[model samples]
Target: MSPPRRSELEMRKELVRLRMEMQRQQLDYHAEPLRHPLRQLGHLFAPGRAARGKGTPLAFGGVLLLTLFGKRLGRFGKLARFALEVYPLVSAGLRQYRESRPPKPPQAPPKPQA
Candidate 1:
């Protein structure tokens, strides 16, 4: 077979480029309907957008409560009793630690320039 001319190679390249572009456009068109839903799903699962320091602890406590109470009430009662018993000692230790820390020196006012 004869070697292909430069013009023929260029034409083939242009045809491939146009075909690829058309396929890309078609893919975009077909995916248009999914864009919004996919975006919403992304936002729903995005860690950065999740609520921070808000009801997170409360939600966790709620789940914990449900799990504790769902299976057995005695376990929850025991946990509560343990927490109550430890509260006073924990508070006393914290109070002693705070009292032992040295107080910060007060800042002096800036001197006025002549």
Candidate 2:
């Protein structure tokens, strides 16, 4: 047989490197400990997607309708004023709820010798 094509040789080398890299990554991931602080920090700032069945077509349609006829559907400047008033109250309620919650109790130590 003639010498192997240059493209074929390069392809085989890349495939071997990818397989080795994937195994190394998998081992590193499995050896690491799971930490919750990073996850909690992320959750604090992100808005999660709504649960299934909660985002119905009618809700989307209502948002579309509000956007399409935004000014004509409401009294002059009332909708903007209402949004301004409601957002702060909702934020305050959430803050108070988080602050007033009790701290987690400590875990018991292992039993001592008899």
Best candidate, lDDT: 1
Clashes of each: 0, 0
What lDDT does the true structure give each of the candidates? 0.60, 0.57
TM-score, model 2 to reference: 0.25
Give one digit per residue, the lDDT tens place, for model 1 in 1-114: 989667988999999999999999998975654565556346433665343212245444543554345335577756764664455466667878889999989999999999
Candidate 2's clash total is 0
TM-score of each: 0.30, 0.25
Q: What value does the lDDT take at residue 12 in candidate 1?
A: 95
For model 1 the TM-score comes to 0.30
What local lDDT does model 1 show for residue 20?
100
lDDT of 1: 0.60
